[model samples]
Target: MKYDVAVIGAGPAGAMASKYAALNGAKTLLIEEHASIGSPVQCTGLISKAALTECEISEGSFVLAKMKGAFVYSPGGEELTIRGKDVKAYVIDRKLFDRELVGRSIDTGADLMLKTRFMGLHHGRISVLSSGERKDIHADIVIGADGIMGSVGRAAGLPRCKKFLSGIQFEAPYDACDAQFVEIFTGNKFAPGFFAWAVPFGRMARIGLAKNAGDRPALHYLEELIKHPVLASRYRGSRTEHVVGGIPLGAPERTVKDNVMLVGDAAGQVKPTSGGGVYMGAVCAKIAGEVAARAARKEMDIKEYEKKWRSAVGRELALGMIIHKSLGKLSDENLNEFISFLNRPGMSECITEYGDMDHPSVLLKEMLKGADKMRLVRLLGVAFKTLF
Candidate 1:
């Protein structure tokens, strides 16, 4: 089979890319290894309202749980509460959300092939394994939207991912959940490299943790976190439906190569700090789709795809990686101090704004002013030292 663009994987990234490519007049094909689009859900699905607004997604699309505030728990049990007058964040039903995204792509005229796995790439042709049959599909350009361990990336010779976080989340029916606030627990005992979260999704809450590069299982860390004195009592009788997965941290060495572009988890576009990629992935995929369409029309250099995407979102991701690394080094006491400092007056608002997945660095740089300037500068200096 032949196509102008062949996208591997049907995740949000691939769906977005294919949707745009097809919308731009390219003959686009989207392939997914799984029979279903969003089965085996693996994300906590917590995101800021800005992301939803930018994506043009309505709040009614998924199970919406409004978050008016957040609570940060220090390892030593110190707590810092950040409350907002406006809506801060929302917890979503990832399975339904992902399905809606893929469905939109299909509705936009992109062809989909499910239960098909990408085998390899040879010349400009891709070999796909479908129902015990090996078929060679040719395309002018290819998109790798496969997850962190993407075969398309390997085949394209993109650099291997350097950082990873093992995450485990569960949907539990809980009687006592602060629907207006999301709770974050920070400390090595609960989660290393990342903080654990309790995201209220209506009647159920999603609880999870991301583990650092050690041999420890994320479940073990989750077990410890749920058993924490503050959380144990509330979660004692919750009914749990578990979701476990791994996420890539850090920026990709190169998101584009000859005749191919990588998007979403395949290119490690996830926010290193929060491990959220839906917004970033969709934004990058939108750009990649336009670039691929132009490339197909011989209107632009294919390499321009990398240049555009990197300029648009790479710096924030780079900064996020540095922050993630610095956060990994903090002890319980350090987290307490950080949270305490953040809760002082306007600092929490700054931090929340910086946590915007799109322009993290802009808000981060803004937070570097005022009384906490020295501390913020010190953190950036450490980030620079570590990243360089």
Candidate 2:
């Protein structure tokens, strides 16, 4: 088969990329290894409201719950509530959500190929195993929207993301304090260099954690998490489902090499602070698709994709990385002090006004301008001080 652009993986990034490619007049081919789209769901499915807008999706049946705010817990058990005046995010059903995205791509003139596994790229041709048949597909440009494993990138001799976090999650019944508030846990005991969460949807929640590279497995930390006083009090000890995955952070130096381009997790377009990719991924994928289509027609250089996407999100991603590292290095005692400071009068109001899940850097900037800036500087220390 011959096409102007071939996109591997039918996830959100791939779907969006192919849709834009076709909409831009490219003959786009969207391929997925799974027989059905959105199988073996890997994400916690919590997405910011801006994420839906970025993906060009409205509130659909795939939205299980709308979240207004979050309850954050320190290792020492101090609670800090970041209350949003309006809906801030959504808890979604990934299976239905992903299918909806891919369906949109198909409707936008992109051809869909199920059970198609990308084998390699050779001499500008794509080798694939489709429906038990080996075939070669020719395309002017190949877009890899695959997951962090990045088979397409490896085939194209691209470098990997700088680092990865091990993550695990499960769905279970829980006695929720508030259905509209997601709970966030921070400290070294349960999550080490990362954090754990209980995202409530009705009487149930998705409980999960992501940790930096470590000697102990994520499961070990998960076991400790459920034993925490806060989680133990509400968790019912019954699990309905489970998911395990890796989240990549730190984009590679380049996302494009010759005719091949990478987007989404394949290019490390995820936020280091929250480990969420859909927002940033969608942003980059749109650029990748438009550039790929134009490049395929020889109207633009494939490298334009790299330039455009980074310009859109590079500073935010860099700031997020700095924030992630600063928070990750705090000791449990320091976390308690930090949370206590936030619990002080007048601080919560500031957080409520500027807090954003998709852009923590904005809140950070606001805090740096506050009267308690010195206190924050003392708590966050040298690393974060560099941001100023």
Winning candidate number (lDDT) = 2
By summed lDDT, the worst window of 10 consecutive residues in model 1 runs over: 379-388
Off by over 4 Å in 2: 382-388
Error of 2 at 248 (Å): 0.3
lDDT of 1: 0.81
lDDT of 2 by residue, 166-271 (tens): 9999999999889999999998888988899999998899999999845789999999999989899999899999999999999999889989999999999999
Residues 93-172 of candidate 1: C-alpha lDDT, one tens digit per residue: 77787778778888888899999999999999999998778999999999999987889999999886777788898878
lDDT of 2 at 387: 41
